[model samples]
Target: MNENFKLLNKKIKILHLIQHMKIGGGQKALTNIISSTSISFEHVVVSTFNQYESELNKLNSSFIDCEKKNILKIIREEAPDIIHYHWWPGFKMIPKNKIPHNCGIIVTVQDPTPVEDIQADIYISGSNFINLFQKHIDGKKRIVIKSYIDVREFTLKKKKNTEIIIGRHSTIYKNKIPENYIKTLLDFSLKAKFIIAGDGESKIIEKLNLEIIKNNAQNKIEIWPGEKIKEMLSICDIFLYITPDDSFEGFANVISEAMVAGIPVIAENKGGNSEQIIHGKTGFLCTGYNEARDFCQLLIEDRILRLKMGGNSKKRGLTFDHTIMGKQYDQIYTNLVKLNNKEKQ
Candidate 1:
């Protein structure tokens, strides 16, 4: 830890209110923040759902399972210096009058357009798109804090593979997958192996599998569980991500993770995807599937180009390192506490 970071270690207690501890971008982001932040700050994570209780225990902070206890009771019991909500639904219905006067409320907007009516002392957005979208909200200090991950965990020694691999991983919602997703994979099936990893609705999974079978691409495309994200990234040479034209991503963590693993990405030029990829340098952003296919084919044919872009991608990905994000968050928490104390006095 830097000596400057230690100055902000005032043992401030932060109570994180989240919807669940599931394996999603928001949950992972929260865990990374808790793990990377200075140990001087105390953390207590309160989850409305307890699907992955074991994962919550892995964090350095304490955990509160709201399934078994009341959130209001837990908040009063913790009486933290800061009450930080990870997403909108987490703090939606909580009464403002019930909270302690000295406690500061911080809401990190994980989605592009979250419910703006929710009151908070500070509103943190993960991307500029979200920050700008919510700029009209009244009476709150808004700031942009990009999401981060533990870059060290993604650093993997590459091994030689028989075929060029293109991969993408996500929670796999209908809107998250492009409409012509199967056709796009079939186009590249002869040249590269495709790996789509993630858990989603059974209907979506069934539809994807049926399409693969219908197109006789069962052997070319492989669908893996979301838990094997690290393994998938290690074997993949290129990261290809595409979502529907109408759908938008707040800040796709998978793209950053793939980049950190030294994989060049070719993502759809929509939402925050444009912000993550530096076109023609780190990776190419496509306006449509045809453009994405061209970019993917370009990298597939030129191994040297792939390596060069991958190196650039890794360099750019380091900007979202956990330590850097942790420092920024530490400063934010420190400032909020100071402001709250001044008002209280």
Candidate 2:
């Protein structure tokens, strides 16, 4: 091995414990950090549910499937310098009193609410908005680590069609499509296409379809299966979001993806969306149905404005790329390890 590689291998090891390896917000972020920091540190991910093998299989790091491996046994064997937990549920995999006293613990909370069940050496909030409602558990320094968006994954393709394509994606059950928003979309049925992409109760989809039929907008609306998010985004000219009041996005990943794809977003002004979207620049965050409708109309009417905002959105989205987050995590890991070593001495 080269000297640099030897040095990297000898550096403090990090064990990342996550709830699952499924393709979701938390899992994606964990995989991105692992991919970004692979060359600089020794890393391993221990997941409770390994039903879906992640794309991270291509990486050099190891993954311990909870089905076959005992997590506490692996922790003792590896003697990792730092243990980072991704989501709250991942904590259940660890036996309460089994953690090594010398190991530095870091828990990244993806929820908008303060975590009360577990204590850690360091805490990371999933977003700046989420940080507002959270408390510093264990009185540790709280760091806000926003979700990283991979700008390269989304191609910047300008809107080509006269028919404006508005897109949205999420777990449909958690985020309800406002009835008034649906009515507003139907109002432009002649000139626009509303594309909804996500997994939801079949009955909910059927009900929405019936509503579209009642408005004579059957041809203007398409509800896609959740798997086709990338394809839907590629064709969309603008992203429209209509979420319920109670819904809180730790960080709206799909909104960032749309922005990075060179599409201006019109999202609900609630939750962490305000942090992701710069109103009147990247996109518009609207408070009411009228504001959202007006924003959509503005984007539809002015192609130049759409292009400008889309470009700004991409620029803003690039700042949230994983490479930047990886470096930040590296710094935190280095400091925490150094502190732990000093305490031991």
Candidate 3:
């Protein structure tokens, strides 16, 4: 048997270190990876903040509460063949000398900003735009492994009502919910029902609510808690996403989720949104709120065009499915382990 095949026959253990198990892009990415990876691989997730105990149980993997115990102690005890760090803030605090040399280190860059004070054998980015920032990180290899979603979970269903539902889902940070985007949604408030779903800072939520009230568009625009994303996408005819001119999305997993759910996406032409959306095909990428409004109106007016774009979106979205992501990670793990073993000899 080939050396690589021999290593693959045995179980490969991956220890995932994350800042928190909270409901966010990074946590969701980790969940998709763990759930989709091959049975030949075993996963153990460690959360630094120890939030979401119930969510961790669903992963079907061993969990370590970092708040209760030292991470180095857990690392030594688990002795993972590969240590994968998501976001990597948790790894910054750990002493480099304490980490076992035998295990390979992989860091997934979840944010657009360049990371510092962290060393890894491999650095994985979610998009080409993010990979540009990771060029500064010295690694054996820097690769783009786009964030993924489980497509089976998203259902492509027919719209039940004539009401045009425009939706956007995110963490609801102030920068994410831009004042200009809010104005754009208000522009079409009468033609469509807008739903902005996600939990975030209370002050930001209040500010949005106040804007809706000031415009007297509360009935037209709804602010929902960020749960049941599939249900949200199922009802929405179009997924309209916008951030401030300055702020940029790393990958926008919500856009991919909406695309797979068979909804046309109208996102800002910034950051990784350009990569996820194909202009005028899978969806439209707008330079400003005016272009977004124009695209939104076009989709709302033409049902056939909307469905056609949606169909295209689903076809393109499957390319980022979690299974594909798992295979890529599996290859990375196998190659790294093989290389590490060779170095030992």
Which candidate number maximizes lDDT? 1
1-345 per-residue lDDT for model 1 (tens digits): 645445545688999988877656788789888888877689888886655566556765788888899888887788888998887443464545567545888888878876454567888888887777786766357888888788998887776899998899988877688776887778754488899999877788788888989888877898888788788998999998888777777788888989899999998777788889999999998877778888888998999999999999999988778898898898888878877777887
Instruction: Give the alpha carbon lDDT tens digit for every residue of 296-336 in model 2.
Output: 88998898998899889888877777778777787788777
Candidate 3 per-residue lDDT, tens place, 185-238, comes to 777544889988888778888888888888888788888887755567889999
Per-residue lDDT value at 269 in model 2: 84
Q: Using TM-score as the measure, name the better of candidate 1 and candidate 2.
A: 1
| TM-score of every model versus the real structure | 0.91, 0.84, 0.90
Provide C-alpha RMSD values for all models, in order.
2.6, 3.5, 2.6
Cα lDDT listed for each candidate: 0.81, 0.75, 0.81
Candidate 2 global TM-score: 0.84
Residue pairs whose backbone atoms clash in candidate 1: none
* Model 1 regions more than 4 Å off: 1-10, 89-95, 98-101, 138-140, 188-190
